[model samples]
Target: MSTQKPIRKAVFPVAGLGTRFLPATKAIPKELLPIVDRPLIQYAVDEAREAGIEQMIFVTGRGKTAIVEHFDIAYELETTMEERGKDLAVLDPTRATPGDIITVRQQVPLGLGHAIWCARAIVGDEPFAIMLPDELMVGEPGCMKQMVDAYEAVGGNLISVLEVPHDEVSSYGVIDPGEADGALTEVRGLVEKPPADEAPSNKIISGRYILQPEVMRTLETQGKGAGGEIQLTDAMARMIGTQPFHAVTFAGNRYDCGSKTGFVEATLALALERADMGSEIREIAQRLLRD
Candidate 1:
């Protein structure tokens, strides 16, 4: 067994007011929006479970109780379904071992970095994974699983990265890259939302991170940056030299469900892949195209 500290908990920052997805998100937390048969947050949580994360820490905000309830076992529904001979297995993904999942309220919408810092109490001193529910990463073994495997082999702060168009580099936290081999790239530094011409690299952080607990300390004093919010990239940048920082190239398709176009694309992509609905969805898409 590798001697590195095991990643047992995953922090999910779901407090964002999904203004990009409103007015549907008016009452519904954007994370609850469905992709096909599952909500956006469900895909993220499933990815965490795929990596053997034992505890889920959701840093929530006002009007986000629905997210917590989504993972809770429905006693009444299950009992009724049992009487009707319904397969209980469909709900298996919704269940988390009691006490294994918990929530902390991030009272203000400071930034991604601040939201993560809210989970510091639960995370304690152990290394943990962070998943942005808005980014839908699809693969056979899942994206976080790929990062955890790399984390086991190397041991330190790791972020999933993808090479985006240079024009889009200004929209994401990008890494100043160094030595690289295969999927691993040494993180020389990090820049959040830098202008394309100023960006050090085209590789952008793809919303999945395996970070050392020490990041919380850096974040505590981290002043607002890049859009006047405590940028996670800024804190991660501060710890790069002190800790072994690297980026893992995710071998998967990532859909940004946080945006309207990306949300539609994810729905169509996933819907058209389902065994039960693929053919019909394809036909519908074809007919719509002809129309």
Candidate 2:
């Protein structure tokens, strides 16, 4: 969509300690947990690939090696499939082609900003995309693609904006809209995790982003903001007048796959959408809901 400054690289911040989903997450990285048939991080990677992202930069902590492996071809399985002449379609979507991925370690459990900063060498002076795997956005044209279209129109920094209920404002980075032209909004400012009643607006920032390289410099100085951790919003807020920042309200259904309820919803929704799983999923969902 953005022919001018086509986004080539994407940064995935997968270093957070998923303390919220403990025990199950004790041995496994939260990003590796399956949402329907594919892992949560796979959904993010697929979204990036669809949007023409060539270099996949993942900022992972310890025990996230599985994520790197997920994007690699299972040599043994692939050889078997080729020999048996199996419909390659059965292969997992998570397996990306060779040389498509690069990983950086976020040794400290700092925060999202720090995690992203870890990939500075890889991103190096270019407009890049950021996709949080926890936010599984489902739609016709994927969320990042929609943002790329909007970015082409207003080239600065673009972030996905969705209207959440007033009470839910505290759970997200809220935006103050300057001007609204359909789905695109001129972002006046952003406040991270403000109290529900103190929030400026109901519109919240989703995980999808198309950010300028300059913001990384701002992040370098941003020691902490809301939670005593390097805050990406803090840096983005500084780029207000300097860079043209806007919020794109894309048409999509987003699920918070980090939470149990949201994960279950995504599982059911994705399963029901699949041709093979639709009938059984519908029957099970209907029976469960009826009871």
Candidate 3:
């Protein structure tokens, strides 16, 4: 067997009360919001599956049952589609085998670290991936697959990063870059939401992460940082010098679907990329802009 354990499980922290898109989010979990034709969580799960993740561990809170039902087989819907002569291939990406998914409840509204900590039991002792449903990345090979390939070569904690404007650095966890190698950057340290002048680098963590199991232990005693809630960045920052920490620059377009602007942009961008509707959407877009 390979000395490095295979990353077979992915933890999805879906417990957040998406206050950003309220009203709509009041009833529906933000993860279920459709980007074009697929929900944001579907993209995350598909990306995880593409990266060879065998089990999906969802850290969910109240009002998130729709997410679980979305992945499970919809008997009536499937039967209706089949009888209506509709191809069920489109639903393939959302369907999961009975035991392939596992869910854990995060009783309170804590931070990202706390949500992930909820799934530590299911993750056990193996390295696992973390996929945030709100960050939708579109790329040729998929973001998680790219990180997995990098993990195979580097074999430690890896996170996907993208260059944001210096002024925008305060909005994300900025990376202090130490060395450069193609798309990989040696992460010297991480500064969570640093001031613009204090940011070490423009590269920001982009939600996809391949982390070692030891990070879970670190979170056990990690105190709340930055946002008054347990922040995953603070825990991972402690592991920097001890482990091989690297940031993989993603070669793709990422949409912050949690925001209104990014959500609209992602929907329009994806719709305009579809072969059947691209031309129509392009014309509509042009017409609207001209008016």
RMSD of each predicted structure: 1.1, 1.8, 1.2
Residue 207, model 3, lDDT: 96
What's the lDDT for residue 70 in model 2? 76
Model 2: per-residue lDDT, tens digit, 1-291? 445577999999988778888988888899989987788988898888888888899898888888888777788988888899887775567667776788999998777888888999999999999999999999879999898888888899999989989999998898988989999999999998899989989999999989999988888888776677887888888999898989999799999988889988899889988998899989988898999
Show the colliding residue pairs in model 2. Answer: none
TM-score list, all predictions? 0.97, 0.94, 0.97
Task: For model 2, state the Cα shift of residue 96 in Å.
Answer: 2.9
Worst 10 residues of 2 by lDDT: 90-99
Which model scores highest in lDDT? 1
- Tell me the tens digit of each residue's lDDT in model 3 across 116-139: 899999999999999998999999
Error of 2 at 1 (Å): 11
Q: Which candidate model has the greater TM-score, 2 or 3?
A: 3
Give me the overall lDDT of model 3: 0.93
